[model samples]
Target: MAELHGTTDDRNEGDASRGVDRTLSAVLASGALGHSERRAKLLRYLVARETSGEGDKIKAYAIALDVFGRDETFDPNSDSIVRVEVGRLRDGLRIFYGECTDPDLWTIDIPKGTYRPTLTPPRVEPVSPPQPAHLNRWALIILPILVVLPLLYYAMRPAPAPEPTAPYPVLRIAVMPFEAAGDHPNLEKVAFGLYTELSLDLSAYPWIAVVSPLDPNEIGADYALKSQLLWQGDNLQTNSQLISLPEERLVWSKSYSIPTTVEHIQDTQLQITSGIATSLGSENSISPDLIVARNARNSKPNLEGFLCFISTYRYAVEPTRTEHLRLRNCLEDAVDAFPEFGEAWAALGVLYMDEVRFGRNPRPGHDSWAEARAAIDKSLELAPLRNAPLMAGVVLSVQAPVQDLERARQLGRKLMELFPRHPPTLALIGSLISEFDGRWPEGHDLVQQAIALENAPPSGFFITPAFFAALQEDDAAALAATAPLTTRTSETELLLKYLAAARNGKTEMMAEQRVLLAQKDLSSDADLVEFVKNRRFHEELEASLTSQLEAAFLVKADE
Candidate 1:
């Protein structure tokens, strides 16, 4: 009889046929049939079944048993073997289709119910004849040359190496505000006079960055410098003093209390300023008498100017009109006494900006912007590269005639580079970026680094970490981070307690906060505003605490 071919007569012929191609292809590809001979035999058996197509379900199971023989019972119902083989077969078909271009040579089809194969003649396509070997000899030789040329070029080319990095620059410094400690009423004034004069003398040095005595807190305690002059005084007697630079191993130990008379004060200040310059090995030493005479000539010595510096520095940390006025008066006197004081002018500019920011100084009617610009301009003229003047420019760029975010960013970056590990610089930049620029994560990181550089001090600095943490909405983290420093019985602690309790869902903690608020006499809106401004809690917490305290106080008043 001629070879019989399979027909799709059963209800599930397509399914079976599809499964057979997939299964046979899988078994052949898996190398799981022990030998190539067995694999080939199994494939042949599957193909034979496809072509015959005469087996009923029972006949199919019997054929499977016959192929396996009695050595191992065949299992038609075992899903583990069938699924694994089917997966392999599907993968094989995919690979074949991917590699083969002509579909007419042979095709694998899975119909509905039958596992079978059918043979058909291959379709042929017309093609051009191959060229003679002698005609292609030169082409073959040139093909190798083309391939080798690329290889040779690649071998000869140099591989690029990474660029070398530059080392961090070294910093120089000088410490000031070496106020004397003493019992004599005027002794402390004399000590401060010495500090001021010495600082001025040191400022003449082109390389030295004189540490201003205006606010010791803002400059930070930790700094690396080649030299430092620590001017300290005995609290009991200003006449007794010690001027020392631990790095230089030098000390100017002295005891001389001058009366508060104008002459004595001038003489005292002159002696110390010139003496410090000589001790520091300065080539040019200022004479004590000249220093005294010069100070006497400017006898007022701009106390207002000094105060302005202090007020501006304080306002930087905690802004207020009272402080602004204090700064204005000081700067005015400072400018009068010393027209060349660039820092004072810069500070004046910043003070005006503060006024404008707080709405105390109007824009159109008030000449605050003009005053600020003029002051900053004069400051820059005097000290072109000074940090104070540069910072003034940065402030103006952000708050004055033009708002330049890029300039502000550049100034901040340069400042940090010049004064690495400077806490106030870091804090200011971090706060600006965090609050105005919407770069919260960077701001938060910068502020946290600033706090770390500050050595985690218990004072106003504690609020840095707390503020950022609250902004991030990580109240528990904020509480834990701030717990150690918030122990002092101040507004800081009260705020911390309130936030910790509020976040922890502790009603009792809130009640305790109420009690503390009452004890501290934080009843008025002004007092509350100050408290809120100085604390670590967020606005929501501040509002909640204010309301709770108000209610609790009201009830107490009724009783």
Candidate 2:
């Protein structure tokens, strides 16, 4: 066995500085070249490459193969050998960085597609200091579960039933984006599909509240009565999203990047959903009827119906009409096969809402609002506390009579109370507070949290956070917050920085922004809004800034 060794003098160094040395030492000791004589040769290769800054996977592999020459070609197919050794190396590097004392020392990261080391500056630690006291208390409390039988018993005890007279508030939950596996072309679709299915499955639990992803308008709301779930792909090859509710900490996380068959997907879904149900302290399992409802054929008709429903509910954002029609037809077929399906009925109602919202004419003699009301009513009749009816209630509140608003508000509050951390509920409540109640700060916080939970790697929901921050007149905060997003462009950042400067009364910042914006040819309101939102600036600022820019440009154009 290779002995792990480190210099004692390194411990006396500051954390950052020590970390760098430890990392370098670990890399040297990784035994990458081979097990015997080749180990020294590998080290030499690494040293040479590091010194020259020209290390790569091919070179590393070639060196390793050469060292083991004629005995056996370096077997790249040996999963166990590669994984175990690489894992050890990774652990060593982690420990080195984690214990480093100096913040300025550059660290080496092994990038994919090459064995070469890439030198990068250390990550900036978040400004918030650790809650040592709280963490210590938690650690102490968690320790000794094995010896403390009574505490273990108490910890494992089922939650007591609520009193009959006491109203049980509806639970609300947010399902973060799920991580995908590998470079699959349909990775996004898979994540979205999982999200949709999980949302549907959870919707069936009467005691558990479910939130839809359709409502992006209400992202920030009170976090007093919610829980969050984070979903991600293992090994960063798949998809992942984090979920958090107000007041409550994270309750569940899942990664699904391992190679899986169809059965595995179903079983994993069941296990995860079951875990979530348990976390919510649900006494009852999902209804067998709901399970049966999911068994319909994956035909075009079913797909169309789902599409129509989604299109209607998401009409405000204007999804592609081609996709919308395709989904609508699929769902319609689903309904045709299962006329008694409560979810189908509820979705049909949402589809009708879409038609009205988008001004799409229905087949002869179909009244969109009337059909919507009927479908929702049927869904409620079938599954009173299920997610579909709850969603229908939300839709009704927006489209129905003033009296229905009270019912919608009541249902909304109930859903929020049950699933307080749910993204859709947060978004809904935030929207209500912003548009109806004029509680901007409260609404802003809710929306911000929701966006954090849903936005993924390549395509993020940027506008919501930017607009909310803009409302607060905190452009600098918005710019700083959005600086790390991979999907946003430099021009977008520059525009936001300019807006922040304008809001902060800094003309120099605005001048810098103008140059970048001009260079990028992104002078339109749409472009400005995209940049502002990506930076979490206010949406209204787009028009206001455009006017200012046009006036400024006119002066320049004349001069």
Give a tens-digit lDDT track for model 1, residues 1-559: 1232433233254544554455455445433221223224534665655445442322334444544342245555431232222222332333344444444434443222234434332344569798788879888789899999999998999975744231111112234444444344444443444444444433443222244322222222112112222223321223323233223333454555543443554465566545544443332232332222221122233433543453454455455456567567768778878897777788888877766554443447668878888999898787655556667777676655456768779877766555444445556677666544557667765665444332223244445455555444665775554554444335555755655556655667556775775565664545655655443233454555555445444443443
Each prediction's RMSD over C-alphas, in Å, is 27.1, 18.2
Candidate 1, RMSD to the unseen true structure: 27.1
Q: What is the lDDT of residue 244 in candidate 1?
A: 31
Total clashes in model 1, counting residue pairs 3 or more apart in sequence or in different chains: 33
Candidate 2, after superposition: displacement of residue 315 in Å? 10
Tell me the whole-model lDDT of each prediction, alpha carbons only.
0.49, 0.47
The numbered model that scores best in lDDT is: 1
lDDT score for residue 132 of model 2: 67
- Which digits, one per residue and each the tens of the lDDT, describe model 2 over residues 1-559? 1111111221323553455455555444432211222233333454345434344333534644543342355655431233222322332344345444556565655442244444444566669976767588776767676569877787899988754332232334545445344454434555565566666566455434343433322322111122222324322223222244433444455555443333445555566666565544432233333223222212222433443443443332334456556556665676777665566677667667666543344556777677778778877676565555666667666554333556767777766654444456566666554434446667655654454333221222343344445455455765544443333234544654555556555666566667667665566546654543332222354455555445444444443
The TM-score that candidate 2 achieves is: 0.39
Q: For candidate 2, what is the lDDT?
A: 0.47
Query: Can you give the TM-score per candidate against the true fold?
Result: 0.42, 0.39
